[model samples]
Target: MQRGMYESRAYATLLLKNILEVADPMHIMNLKPLVFTEVSDRISDKATKAALHILVNICPWGRNRHKTVEAGAISVMIELLMDEITHSKIDNVGSNLALLSLNLNAPYKIHSIHME
Candidate 1:
């Protein structure tokens, strides 16, 4: 049954995805750390990359979806940090853009990172 499937750890990622789609600011703020930790611990690099790609593409600037993507993308960024090339190549533009879109007043601290 759907309930049983949702209860399983194996379906955690899918559940996260669904939650992300409909989550509000408070929901996203609370869930961010937990989801990041889980993705950091459980997802593979390939999955991380794919997730990042999806997050980046689906969540555009100045949209509600951007917040969801930002939360999820932060996890992908942490996971990507394990690989030198990816860590360096993946810029913080997306993060900055997401923050800007949300109208959150925070200084941009990630722009100094050199992506190559």
Candidate 2:
């Protein structure tokens, strides 16, 4: 998957972006905990970042955002961010931050709650 990102960035982004349109994003939500575990287990810059990018990108849509939050993304991402901070992996830090930001903002996307 990392290699695929390098081979074609557009395709990689598109693949992640389009996952929200699937027949059942909730199914994907169901497996997200396992996926989150795998992401932390992988711990490689490219792999983890790709996974986070995919997860975060899918979160802007209201339903997808709710599903992602239900998947424990906030907690998982916080843990990942802490780990990345300890190692000072600047490359992954940006992605981790983005994931956290998206994860936190996801709840607001569910309703009329305004976000500053």
Winner by TM-score: 2
C-alpha root-mean-square deviation, candidate 1: 9.0
Error in Å for residue 27 of model 1: 1.1
Error of 1 at 84 (Å): 11
Q: How close to the true structure is residue 76 of candidate 2, measured as C-alpha lDDT? A: 62
Candidate 2 lDDT over residue span 1-110, tens digit each: 33444435434444543564453645544544444433333334554455555566445544555555566665665676667677867676665565567555765432
Candidate 1 Cα outliers beyond 4 Å, as residue runs: 1-10, 44-116
lDDT of each: 0.42, 0.50
- Candidate of highest lDDT: 2
Model 2 ranges with Cα > 4 A deviation: 1-45, 89-99, 102-116
Candidate 2 vs. true structure, TM-score: 0.45
Q: Cα deviation of 1 in candidate 2 (Å)?
A: 13
